[model samples]
Every structure is written in C-alpha cells, then in structure tokens.
Target: MLSKQLTTCLAVGVGILGLGFARSNVAVAQEKVTLVERFDAANPYRVELKVRLSGRLAVAFEKGKPPEVLPFSGSSTLVYDEKVLPADEPRTAKAIRVYRETEFARTIDGKEQKADIRPAVRRMVVLRSERGKKVPFSPDGPLTWSEIDLIRTDLFSLALVTGLLPAKPVSPGDKWNASPNAVGDLTDFDPIEEGGLVVEFLSVVTLNNKKYAKLQISGTVKGVTDDGPSRQQLSGTAYFDLEANRLTYLNLKGVHELLGPDGKTTGRVDGTFVMTRGPASRGDGLTPTDLQGIALSPTPENSLLLYDNPDFGVKFLHPRRWRVGTVQGKQLTIEESGGGGILLTAESNSTLPTPEQYLTESRAYLAKQKWTVNGSDQPRRISDTPDRVDRFAIDAEVDKQHVQMEYAVVAQAVGGATIAARLPWAEREELRKDVDRIIKSLQIIKRIEK
Candidate 1:
C-alpha cells in the first residue's frame, strides 16, 4: 500500500510540469505579433499636446564675472484637429490642421506672463514646407510671433508618428533602430549630425482597458536648429495601440542644450512632453462641412506671417523669412534671415510730422549713430487716406558695411509710428517685393490699454 501511494504522487507532479510548459509556449506566441503603421486618409484625428519645462538660464552681468543662474518655467497646451491628405509619397504627405485652442505661459522672477493670441489666425489652414520644416499659414492673415513659436518646433506630425514603428514583427525584448527622420522630428533636430535612438519592445500591457505595445527609447544626438547647434539626450516610452494600429501615446523627457560657436554649452533646457492622438470626438472642430472649400495649396500672400500688435497701435504682414525680435521701449525689431531687418518706434505726439520734416529728423538720428549717408532720396507720400504714410530711401555706410535703409512714418490723429528697414545693398532688389509687402500692409489701430 505504501509503494502505490508514492507512485501516484510522482505521476501528479509530472502532469503539473507539463501544463506549465504549455502555458509558457502560449505566452511566447502572443508576444510575437506583427506591428505595422496604417493610416486612413478618410479618418480625421484630434491631437492633444502638452509640454512643461523648468531650467536655469545662465546670465553674465559682468564680462569676467561668473554667470548668474536664473530659474524659469514655461508650459504650453495645444489642441488641434488634423486630417491626413493624400500624397505622392506616404512619408512626406502633408496634412490640413486647424487649431482649436492654444495656450502658452512663462514664469520668471516669480511672475507668470501668458501669451496674448488674436483670434483671426486660428482659422483653418494648410501647412506648407519651408526648408523641410512645416509652417502653418492661412489666406486670412499671417500668424503672430506667439502663434508661430508654438508650432515652430517640437510638433510631432503624422509622418513622424508612422516613422517610429518597426518595419518587421517585434517580440518582447526585441530591439531595433527607430527611424532617423522620426528621431530628428521628435527632437526638433534637422539633419541629425550623429547618434540615433534604439527602441526596445518592453512588453504588451493593458492601460485604460486597451492593450498597448510598450516601447523604450534612449539616445543622444547632436544637430543643427534654426536657433543654432543643439545637443539633446532623450529617454522616453511610446505606447502603440495594438487594436487601433496607431501610435496613440508618447511621453518624452529630455535635456536640450544649446551650443555656441566654440561648442560650449550656452544654455540647457530640461523638459517633458506628453502627447495623445486619436479619432476626433464630436465638436472637436474639423467636421466634413467645415473642411469644405479650404485651399490646400499655398499662395505667396497666404504664406506670409502676420504681426498684430494692438497695444502699440500697429500691425503688419511679413514673409516667412523674417522673424520678430526684441522690443525695447516703444521700438520693435523684425529681422530676416538674410541680414535684413526693420526697426519700428511709436510715439504719442499728436502733432504729426510732414514727409520732409520726418526725413530730416531720421537722417540726423542716423548720423548721430555714426552712419555716413552716401545718398538720400526725396520723401514721397505713399498714401493720404485714414493715415498719412511717407517714405524715403537712404544709402549709408555703417561699421564698414554698405546698407540700404528705408524710412517711413505713418501719422495718425492721436500718435504716429516711425519705420526703419535695413538690408544689404546687394540684396535690396532681391528682397524688394517682400519688403514692400510688409510696408504696404502696415496699419495703425486704437491703442488697447492692458
């Protein structure tokens, strides 16, 4: 009887071991599913992007003194409706995007300043490529500095999302190279100078009642940006929805360091971005009827960006090549990438100056700044309607560089604006049309008390 009981216990142990091996094989089979990126042009998606960053800026009060570090924090939230448009090449396809809401704020010295966005530029528009970068513009008008800045960098487009996936089936613990284009776009780095991201399939997990293929990515790359050379190190996870066949969620945190000419770090930005993409819900904007009649092609006028500054009682339209710069006192400066710029100053003098008087005063001011006026044109009245507009041109030499300067004054009943634009003499004719568009579109508005 004792020998028979021992045999039964051995048999039961063997049966339990066999069942455990069978279940392990089933789990391994479940992990080996193929992941492919599929997009449907008929479907429209709503994307919510949020970013928050806090870092210290190095400031040198004295030339030889050690730099002072100032703490600053900034956050931005943007919700937009996007529809993928058909393309000859799926990788470079453009999309129509309508921004429903955008909010940006910066905190410094214990004070927060929120961006003031106008409502007009928020309308429906097509995104056009400028030097391999996507820029959103509308037929209605140009976008302001705040609007353009928000969309300029760190925007993860459809092409980028599709590029992040593997070309073949990946199992748990499998690793592959995330596309270089995807990494560049994700980090706002164009033409990645060196290094790339390696993605490792972590596991399949359930989040919010949906299955997701969790992925881990880490790398460091050095690249060039519009601001200059930048180095960034990224560590993040991406959630690719298995059933939906889409990269629905991504959360990336990284340190972005700006390098100077000597390749030394001038500043560093540590930030995190969390983005989610999915089908649009009702009332998220981008209904079929709302998208009808929207122009997908960009015209020269529609591609231009608008600068609307109601506080200073002035607004104007400029080309994409020009970027708005620092504001000192009542003067605002806009600069073009090709060494051309405009300086505008507003004054509250009720007594408006005539074209001749304005020209004489401007030349005198330029002379005081050591500018040698080689030639000067007579002032002319360009418009005499709601506001009187007068303009004159000057050929001058300053700091051993020959430049062409255009001076204009828009006079109104309450106050007036003085405009000064400078560009390299050789490129004046090449940039003539763009400069004229800016000057012609200038308008004075009633000053809004903030």
Candidate 2:
C-alpha cells in the first residue's frame, strides 16, 4: 500500500513540472513589440472639438454638453506609415483612426449639466504637409479614449505629443521631426515648434527611479498672439515601458517668445509637458495623494533658512524690527540702523579648508573687485564651540565706507561645507555682534524618541 501511494505522488509532481514547461514555452513564443509598433498599430482618429466659451459666444445645443474635468482627459491620434495609407487615396482608404473623449461641467439656461462625450470613429484626410514631399498618412480618424484623456489632462495636445517621442543621445546636425506640421520657417520661438520643430538628443538620465533619454529641439513659430514670429525651444526626457510595450513617460519643458500687435516678438510664455501610460493596477489613476500642498511663506520673526532640496537645512531668528529683502541667490535680508545691511547666503565648498586657508582663497577672490582689506583679527568661537573665527576690515574706496566683518567659519571632517551669512561693509561691526550672538545660540534639536 505504501509503495502504491508513493508512485501516485511522483506522477502528480511530474505532471506539474511538464505543465510549467509548456507555459514557459508559450510565453517565450509571444513576440516582443516595440513602442513604435504599438503606437502605429493602434487605431488613429480625430474630432471636431468645440468647447463652450462662457462670458462670450451664444448658447446653442450644437455646442453639446460641457465635458467633465476628469483627471487624465484628453485627445490623441496615432501616426501610421504613409506607405500603407497614402493621402491621395479615396476617403474610405485614406481614413485615419483616432481616440478622443471630453468631460466637462456646463451651465445651460441656469441648469448645470455634466457630460462625457466620446467619438465612435471619425475620418479625415491630410490636406497639407509642411514638407513638399508625397503626403504620408491622413490626419483623419476616430478618437481613442487614451487620446481624449491626454488632451483634457494636458493643457496642449501638440506640445504633449512632441514631448512623448524618443530622445536617445544623438550627435549634432542630426535632423528630427518635432511636430505634426513640420515644414514652416521656425527660428525664434519657444520649446515647441513655431513653424518647423527639430530636436537632437543630448543626454540620458535616470530619474524617479526610471531611465530616460533627453533631447534638445528648436524652431520658430507664431508668438502667443496672432502677431509676429518667435523662436521656441524644447528640452527634456522621454522613455518607453518594456512591460506595457508603450511610450511611458515624456517630460518636456521650455519657453517661447510672445508676440505683440505690431508683428514683433514681445516677452515669453513658458510651458511644460508630462505624458505617461494610463493606470494599470486597480485604484491606480490620479488620486488625492497626487496633489501637492501649497508652500507657506515664512513669518517675519521666523525667516526661511533653506529651501533647496538634496541638502536642505534652515535656521530662523527674531528679526528685532529689521527690514528684510532678498540678496542675489540667497534669502534672509536685513537692514541695520547703522546704515549697514546683512546678507545671509548658503555657500558650498568642494573641500572644507581651514579658516585661514578659506579666508585666503576668499580674500583673493574679493580682492579682484578692488575692495581693500584694512585689518584682520580673531573673534570668539560660536556654535559647537567652533575651532576658529576670523575678523576683517573692508574699506570701500569707491562707495566710501568703513566695514568690519566677522566669519565664524566651522570646520567639518567632510569634504564639503557651507557658510550662512554675508554682510555689507558699512555696518559690519554692529551686524557682526548680532550674528555672533545668533550663532552662539544655535542648538541642534533632536526629535523626541518614540
């Protein structure tokens, strides 16, 4: 009886192994699809999109119900090889596929209505191409759900699509298509194509724990208004998802010139594009967690010490009724009664040189500005009982002022360090005394243990 049972168990184990092998073979046989293939094969289309413009224009039923402002709503169309579908063909053969949807809230006749509209299929033929070559694919088709979602979520569709393309590193002088309409004279404009957009890949980066290829594209286009022309630039990252077999993320950012009524370039309008694959797992779309909190301004008594990330740290103090303003790249500005100003900045050094060595290098750099150093001395140590302190007299011949400054520079074993305060020459002595006190009061606070 024991031998029979053992034989049965062995048979079951062997059957399970055989089934696993068959499944693995089937998975291997499935052909791998690239991003381009998936996009091209997907049906392409377009829609006669018309949104109701409140505060202007008349109310009409043809305007249709307003679309819901759902997260990830927009419109998009896939591009197919021209060889398969020529533009000169009949409407049936030349028809292109498109995916589109719109969700919005609208008030009609004092009644608020919410609507979601999607195109079953729409066809359009390519009327014109920027390049005077044989027209490739027609711009006509039914809209897809993905395309409409993107259009609604992204402020601009063309800009978002251009950003989604591959941007692997490429040498200079390489020609690349930067827009759907790629044949106009684009010179001075923004990141998106003004008339004709061409981009060249520059580098690659791994961000948000994902790898991305970067590119730099430039061209000229019409200014923000229907006035003149301006140059535009596009630079950012793009990548493909191996698992989804689609273009996953495209992050493009840049600026373009705004034009005036005289047909001349004016100021500029900056823009950004971020495109990603739709949600995969359950409860994975945009959620409340996606929204970021607004940054609160620092109070008068408590100044914001540091805001830069990666090495962020801050310190604040009672202003004692001092005027505050920004200076250069640093914050925490103060004006003293003695006709002097204090500028607090974070200075980063590659190496933590000794106090004397740091001052020697710093003074040399400062001397280039022709500011004379009248005298020097050592002051009392502050915070952590620093090992060294240096005081110097800066005489401004041009501005005609006598300034005394003190540096409570501390040394750390690490290679890099930062200095927090920079004071003006005229009121150095008085500000120096307060700075010394502030530094001495520095105490490293530790979070209470759980």
Candidate 3:
C-alpha cells in the first residue's frame, strides 16, 4: 500500500470519471468570487472517500531476497461523520468517528480479500483540536497509532483541501499564492523544488444544477523516505460546492518517482485517487442506507463491540459477548462465550512464508495429535489476506457421551493485517451467521512509520 497519509492526500483526492463541466450545454459564469471557507457548524460533514489504486509497487523486504513486485487494482471506501467547531483560532472536531463503517479490499496477484472494520473499532472517540495545528486530538485515551493517523489524515484532508480557497475575493482568471505551510503540510513541500504550488480561479460552472467554483490546483514535493528519495507532483481540477464550503468532487493525476543517489528516477507510481463527499451519518437519529442486503458487503448492524489498534493499523468488530485477550502483544484473540473465537495479528514484513506453506505444516502437527483433517480445500476469500480453511474432527467426552466435534482452522497473509479464525462445532449451528458477520467486518490500515 502507498504510505497512509500520502495515499489520502494524493490518491483519494483524484477524480476517476474524467468528466469535465466544459460541456457545450452549460455556460461558464465569469463573476467575482470570494471563496469564503466556512462549513455548517450545526451538521456533521459526512464524507465518503473512494480511492482506486492500480500499478506495480516495488516493495523491498529482506536483506538478500529481491523486492516483491505486486500488481493491484481496487477501490476502498471509508465513511466519516465529523463535525468541526466554529472557526475561532483553529478548527477542531466536536465529536468525530468513523460514521458508517470502514471497508477495504484488494486483489493481489489473483487473490482478493476484503473486510468491514466497524465491529472492532469504537466509533465514540472524542476529538479535540489544539491551537495553530489542524490535527485533532482525542481526549478519550487509548488511540492506536494508526487511528491517530487516520484521524489526522481526515482532519488534514479537510483543512488542506479547504485551504485552497483564496484569502481575498477575485474574478475568474485570477491566481493566488496558496499557503506554503498548508501545501508543505500535505505534500511535505521541498523548498528546493522549482515552481511553487498555486491555485487558479476557473470560471464557475453549473453541474447537476448546483453552482460550484471550479479550481485548478498544482503543486510539487520532492523528498526522501527511508526507502529512497521521491518526487511527487499533483495537478488537477476540483469542484468546490459554493454553498457547502467543501470539496464536492476532485480529479487529480499524481506521479511519484523513486530517485537514486544521483537524483534519477528508478521506479514510478502512476495512480488516481478519486473522492466523493456525501452526507454525514452522525447517529443523530439518521442512518445511511444500502441497496438490498449485500452479503460480504457493508450493511447495518446493531450495537456491538469495537477493538481499534492503530499502531498495527487494524480494527475490527465482534459481538459484545466475545472476550478480547492477547496471546502476544500484537497477536490478539477474541473468544466466544462458550466455544471458539478469532485470532488476529499484524505483520509488516511481506517476505514471510506463503499461506499454503504455513497451512501444510499446521495440518501435519494437528494430525499427530489424533485430529483427522476433513473436507476439500476450497476457494473462499477472507478479510485482507489470501486464506483457506479446513475442517478437522476431534473426539471428546461431553455429558459422559463420546462425540466428534468439528473445528475450522484458517491462516492467511497480506500486506496489512493477517487473520486466523476458527468456528467451533458447539456454536457452529447457533452462531453460524454471527461468525460470518464478525469476520466480514475486519478492517486494515497501513501503519505509519516514524
């Protein structure tokens, strides 16, 4: 995955459809515009972020092995309902959290897995902002490093995108110097880079009967990460809702080139991040709806439990009855009331063994313990990882009667979080649907490195 904040900044802000408002049917208005920046304080702004990532990314893992080259094309949706306090010194969130749910899926090589993250992540964290900076702080203790980054990206995106508005009113064809600080904050602006970022006031164009301020935004940031030096450039058009004071739609093309010691390009990233803003789902007695009951898709759920771990960049939802504990600091397990549960872990190293290799060794160990492996290995995609599950039978004495109980074992791998879950025979029939629901909602975000 692209770096967490960088993905949201460059990839999500892009527009995919490539439709321009310069159609022959609409007439562009050449009028003076103030571009005042203010959002409704009464209602929480609900934003639906959709990002498309495609192209080959070179990921270096081990000391001797060659970098793994992975090709991926997928869309991830994140819903946030955040209400910003009125502008005084610095804007902050009154009460902001993942509004509807967090969902992501990717197809690596030829395997695909996705999950919903609401069940494991609490949606009640309170965000408070400090002076001067737009980063939102959560007074409610215990925020995962990744969750903090998620909140920061969301907050930063709002501020960074809105800051495109010019401080003074001007007419069409006018240009202004965008705040260097805002631009630098989002893109890690490089002072040595030529041609600083600028904002142009394009003519207002009517779209779908709504008035908008069309803008042309361009910027470049050349810097270096631990992996290598990189140069990122962004140029595109954005449609800002005149009345709403928010970016309604945006389409930007980005180029990120990995540089060698001599400042020459070695690898390049070409992708578009198209985003759309929707109404907020603040649980203020209103809910967002889906078309039909889409299985393995995001749907409505009654109140449950939330386990958010940002440092590992994973969050999940399980039933309130499930007990959460840790086998290892990063390896977590959620146990059922009287039966089986799930095992979740996060790994950054992609050079680890494949899922098939791990499963084969696991089955051999279980066979020695008198457990007979049953069923054929079928293709069923699990959350985030390429995974497979097998059935096994173990004889046990229950109520003084000999019985054969079935258990499921799964092991999988991905770039973000890896999951291993089992469904126990005792609760298989009664909690079958619950088991499916719990696993379907696992969410993963790439952890941010210092």
Candidate 4:
C-alpha cells in the first residue's frame, strides 16, 4: 500500500509540471515584436513600383435616363535606384531617385497613348512633406508634365510604408491606425476630411528562410485633388521583413471616385498596385561615385522643364507655370492656369519670312479681329541675327482692355515656325520672362516640308 501511494503521487506531480510547460510555450509564442524601418545612408535601395487602373469616365446619371460611362484604363511600371539621405532637421529623410525605366500607357474611349522615358533623362531629387513628395528638377532640366505624372502616381512612399508600422511592439491580432500623411499619400487626397487606414498585425510567416510580419490594411478617405473632390476605399497587405527591419513589400487595391464641384460623382476608377524594395544589387549602377558632382538640389534654371516635340522638330524649355495644352496638325498651344496663352504654328516654305514681313502679317491678322494697335507698330528685333529668328512683340487693345502679344518666327532651311503669345498688359513683365526663355532656348532640328 505504501508503494502504490508513492507511485500515484509522483504521477500527479509530473502531470502538473507538464501542464505548466505547455502554458509557458504558449506565452513565448505570443510575445510582441517591434517592426521598424532601418535605412542606412551608405546603402542604396532598388525600388520597383507597378500600377494598373481601369474604370469609367463621364459617369452620367439623370432621371429617366440610363447611366452613361466611357471605359478607361492605364498602367505604369517604374524602377528606381534610390538613395535615402538625411534631410532638414524636422523631416526624417529625402530620396534621390534615378529612374532606370519609366513606361506608361493609357487608354480612354478606345484611344491609347504610350510613352517610355529615355534612360538618360530619368532622374530627380525627391523631397517629402505631409502633403506629398516633391521632385525638384535637376540642374539639367525639369521633367515634362507627363513624366511628372508617372513619377508621382498614387503608390507607397517611404514614409507611408514606415507609418503603417505600429509605434509600439504589437502581438498577433493587434490593430492600429495609420498616420494622416500615409493615408493621404496612398489615397492621393490632400486635406483629408475623414477616415484613415486601419492596420492589423496578422502573423509572422517565413519566406526564403527569413521571418516576415504580415499586416492587413483597410480604410476609406475623402478629400480633393487639384482637379476636383475625390473619395477612395483602400485595402492592402504589407510585409515587414524581420531580419532586414524594413517594410519590403506591399500590395494594395482600391476604388477611386471623382466628384464634381456640386459633389456629384463624375468618374470612378478601380486600381491595384504592388511595390517592392530591396538593397541595390552589384550591377545596379547606383553607387555613390555615380552621384558625385551631380546637383542634388534645384535652381530656377534647372527647374525649367524641357519640352521636346520631335514631330515638329522643335525643342525648348519652359517654366512649371506653363503647361502644354494641345498639339494638333502643325500647331501647338501652351497655357498657364487661368493666365497667359501661347500658340505656335509651323509652316513649310521655300523661303523664310523676314522680321518686317512677319510683323506686317501679324498686325494684319489682329486688325481683322478688331484689335487696335495700342503701342509702337514697328517690329523690334529681339535677336541680332534676323536670318535665324525674327522675334518681336506688340501691344494691342480689344474688348476695351489692353493686351500684350509676342511673336517669334524661327527660320530654317526650307521651313519656319511662328510663336504667338497674348496676355494682360499689366502682367507682361512676369509672363514675358517665360516667353523669352523659350525663345532663347528654342532649337529647330528638322523641318517638315509641306
């Protein structure tokens, strides 16, 4: 009887100990972990961003009328060799991105346009803010409007990716909200009026023998773009590489709606994006030496954008305030937002027009439109070489308001180009500065013979 009692007691003690060991194991598995970004200035990163958006434009809904919509789709793939460096005291860092490839295409109503930026011209210095990232022009030249659009597409930013991580350690199933800047950048909404991204720590998974923390994100945002008011519903996943201590991969899909001035929905888009960032490889060519002697900041002259039109064989530089409006046939139009206007016409001829002859033609055309010549009618020679370019300006009156007009006739072997600009007389000095820059930099490579 004594032996039997001793055996039973030992068995019970062993069972209790086994239960305690199991409980301890569970606790260890549930421990929290801190996920943070570790960016070293000495190391460069290669980032690949790909996006595809498809939706409808001109969504019209009227009483007793079927909804009408036009199909639209666009895609862009961009690869960048980026270096994250320290920035101003308050801001964390800025990135100098050298774009290796930028390919974009868009189709609306069965019309498609595609462009691939040349390798030599793909570079910019990025400055981050709560609003968004700003790409200051290089000392060489500014990016064209279309190029800027592709570069600034709605995708993950370094700050946005970092902001999604919890400030404190988070265990599995823990949830938190992302910062406003992150939400705004992801949604392409400025001045976010409502809603934010909710992030949840899903679990840790192993990939390629490395542990990664998976996160789930979902949210809705309402705000405005420069065009109009907008709303977005975003849902995505991000992977935090525990070994690397960085957010290396992200995938997001969302629906975007554009609203009119009256708060009515005008358009809608369904889009998805995937971004991956990793250390630059050996042959990536983003070494510190490659960036040596390269200007990392923008000056006024370098900030000017290069506008190249191979069809007309005309190339020039213009400021950011000016935008290319339309190009049709042999004519091109550039306009400022609610301000000045410029028009250019290309004509093929056996002879180039003289400065005096061009001026006579310009005055005659304006006179036919009831514009009274307000100032001197003589064509003032802007360039000493009238044989190359006959450029001049005139002041006129129409609709009881003073108007200033500048004209340039670029002379070539067998063809010529004409530039005409009209703006308010009071704002001539500032607007003229932009026109003068274009005139000085304009180059005619080849002429289309009529």
Name the candidate that leads on TM-score: 4
Clashing pairs in 4: none
- The number of the candidate with the highest lDDT is 4
Residue 381: error of model 4 in Å? 4.7
- lDDT of residue 416 for candidate 3: 37
lDDT of 1 at 114: 90
Candidate 1 vs candidate 3: which has greater TM-score?
1
Model 1, residue pairs in steric clash: 142-306
lDDT of 2 by residue, 1-450 (tens): 112322222232233323322332222112322223232312221212222223211222345553232212222222211111233423312222222334556454455655342332221122222231111111222222323332322222222343334344343234466644222212222233335556654333333333223335554444331224454555544444334333344444555554434655444445554443322222111122321231111232222121111232233332343444554442345565555555543333333455666567656755887766775554334433342333333333325545554454543322123243445665555566666654443222221111
TM-score of each: 0.77, 0.27, 0.52, 0.81
1 versus 3: better lDDT goes to: 1
lDDT of 3 by residue, 1-450 (tens): 222322332332332233433465245666677777555545555555666666655566787765676665555667666554434334453434444657667776667866443343434333334321333322222233334344433434445555667888778888986665455444443442544567898777654455667788787777654356778788877666676566766566777676766787666667665555544534442222321232211123433445666666666666545766665755677787766666665554453335554455545655775555553253233433353443333344434433333333343333333444455555556555555555555555554222
User: Model 4 residue 142 lDDT?
Assistant: 65
Structural RMSD, model 1: 10.7
Where in model 3 is the C-alpha error above 4 Å?
A: 1-25, 64-69, 72-74, 86-95, 107-116, 120-157, 180-196, 224-228, 278-450
For each candidate, the alpha-carbon lDDT, in order, equals: 0.72, 0.36, 0.53, 0.73
Deviation in Å, model 4, residue 122 alpha carbon: 1.9
